[model samples]
Target: MKQVPPEYYQKLEELQAIDFVIVELTLYLDTHPKDQDAVQQYNQFVHHRKKLKKEFEKLFGPLTNFGYSYSDYPWNWKDAPWPWQV
Candidate 1:
């Protein structure tokens, strides 16, 4: 068994928090599509999400599956307990 580092969980939580904001922004855009500020914010969050995911994958293995993420072994996010379960 492998012992996961504490930072791994921290980064994962950060990613999840960003994802939640993105989702809320998505919903806002669906109704306020003409808001430029909202659009820019959404794009910024998206960029942050991409960068964070890449850093996380590099340190902790792939965070996704189906070839979307690269890893020396494989995307182990689905290997055991779900992120929420941890």
Candidate 2:
């Protein structure tokens, strides 16, 4: 497997963690949509997720595929050491 920097794991873990929270909060909001505090927290986490995603993509490469993320002329999605391979 190709070697990746330590920061890659750190940032990827952070992104995964925030993403997980967003999912949980989304489920919560679905049941308790009237909770303003939960709504606010959910929005905050979404924003943070976006920022972290950008940082990760800029440093590493596209972390997702399809419409969620863009690829340059020469796609890098198939690059060595996919997230799982790391």
lDDT of 1 by residue, 28-53 (tens): 99999999999999999999999999
Task: Provide the TM-score for each candidate, comma-separated.
Answer: 0.83, 0.89
How many pairs in model 2 have backbone atoms within 3 A of each other, for residues 3 or more apart or on separate chains, i.e. clashes?
Answer: 0
Model 1, C-alpha of 80: deviation from truth (Å): 9.0
Q: Write the per-residue lDDT of candidate 2 for residues 1-86, one digit (tens) a residue.
A: 66789999999899889989999999999999999999999999999999998888878888887689766658877663567777
Off by over 4 Å in 2: none
Q: What Cα-based lDDT does every candidate model obtain?
A: 0.83, 0.86
**Candidate 1 regions with alpha-carbon error over 4 angstroms:** 73-85
Root-mean-square deviation of Cα positions for candidate 1 versus the true structure, in angstroms = 2.6
lDDT of 1: 0.83
lDDT of 1 at 4: 81
